[model samples]
Target: MSSSRTARWILAAVAAAGAYAPAWAAELPDRTPGLWETRALIDGRYRVVRRCFKQGERSAFIDAVGVGACSASAQKTIFGGWMMQADCRTPKALLSGKLLVSGDFGAELQGRVVTSVTPAAGGPVVKRTAMTFSSRRLGECATTPRG
Candidate 1:
C-alpha cells in the first residue's frame, strides 16, 4: 500500500482499539490529560502522530473513533490488558479486526491490531499493525483568544 494509505489504516486501527472499550470503563486507567506521542509500525514502516488532550478529553477521543462507522464485539478485559474484535466501514472499504491493548494508560500503552480489508469492489487483504504510545503532562494547553 502507499504510505498515506498505510498511515490511514494504522490510525484507524489505533482509534478502533480505543473505541471498543465498554461504556462502563470509559475512564482509562492511569490516563493523564496532556501531550501524547504515538508510534505505529505497519509492515516494518513506522510513523508517529502527536495529540494534546485537555481535561475529560479521553472520552471524547474514544467517541471520535470511527464514530458511527464502527461496531465492536467480543470485548473482554484480560490480565494487564483488554481485547476486542471490531468492524468498521470507511468510505471506500470495510475493515474488520482483532485488537489487543496493554500497559498503563497513564504513562504508556501498547496495542496490536490485525485487520482484514475488503474494498467496495475487490478481494480482501490483511494487515497487521503494532502501536506503542505514551503521554506526558504538558502542564496545560495554551489558551486561545476568542475571535
Candidate 2:
C-alpha cells in the first residue's frame, strides 16, 4: 500500500478513538442533581461562584469555573450564597481560595460583604448573591443586615 493510504488509515483510527473517550467516561449518577449557585470569595482578589451536590452521604463542593474543582468545606447559613470555609476561612485565603458549596448552600454569605473573591463568578446570572450583599453593605454602612 502507498504511504498515503497508510496515513489515512492511522487518522481514521485516531478519530474513532477520540469519539469514544467521552462516552466511556460519562457518569451515570443515581441522581443527576442541579447545582445551586453559591457566592464565595476567591484569592481575596475576586468573587467566585460555586455549586454543591449530594455525593452519597457526604456533600461535595465545587468551584464553578471553566474547570470544576472539588471543595473541602461548605456551610449553609441564614442567608443565601456561601462562605467557603475550605481555605477562605484562613488568612492566606486572601491570595488563594475557592468558594465551596456544601453543608449549607449559598446561605452564609448572602448578606456578608467582603473585599475580594476567587474563581470570579460575576454577571447577571448570580444577581442574587450580588444584590443581597451590595444592598446591605452600600445601603447602610453602619447597621448592616444581621446575618
Candidate 3:
C-alpha cells in the first residue's frame, strides 16, 4: 500500500482504539453498546467510519486493529477524560504514542494520539505522526440472531 494509505489505516486504527470500551485492558470508560460514528483527521484530511458494537463484545475494536499490537503503559484520569501512553511495533517501525481522551463518553468523545515512529532498522531519523479523532453514539446496533 502507499505511504499515505498506510498512514490513513494507522490513524483509523488509532481512532478505533478509542471507540470501544477496553475497560478491562486499559481502564477506559465502558462505552455504551451501540453504533458509533468516528471521524478522524489525518494529514489534514478527514475520514469517517462507523462501527457496530454488540452487547458483549468488549475487545472488538482492538481486535479489528490487530490484537496485541499495541500495549498501554501508563494512564491517569484527566479533567474531562484520560491520558495514556502506548507503544506498538509495526512492520517497519516502532511507535511510541501518548493518547489523550476526553468528553463524557456516553454520547460524545474526542481525543488525540501523537506518535513518534522509529524505523526498526535503527535509523538516525524518526517520523512523528499525530491524529485527532472524535466519536459519537449513533444509535443502537442492529441485532443478529444467535447461532
Top candidate by TM-score: 3
Q: Please name the candidate that would achieve the greatest lDDT relative to the true structure.
A: 3
Clashes of 1: 1
Ranking by TM-score: 3, 1, 2
Between candidates 1 and 2, name the one with more favorable TM-score: 1
TM-score, prediction 1: 0.70
Please give, for residues 1-147, the per-residue lDDT of candidate 1 as tens digits. 454664565564463235434442543353566666667776566767666665544434334345677676667788778876767676677667676788766656777766676774667574444444333343445667998
Relative to the true structure, how large is the alpha-carbon lDDT of every model? 0.59, 0.24, 0.66
Cα error, candidate 1, residue 20 (Å): 4.9
Distance from true position, residue 90, model 1, in Å? 2.2
Model 3 — TM-score against the truth? Answer: 0.75
Which residue pairs in model 3 clash with each other? none
Model 1 poorest 10 in a row by lDDT:
129-138
Q: For all the candidates, what are their Cα RMSDs to the real structure?
A: 3.7, 21.3, 3.4
lDDT of 2 by residue, 97-133 (tens): 2221212211221333212233234322211111111
My TM-score estimates for the predictions, one after another, are 0.70, 0.19, 0.75
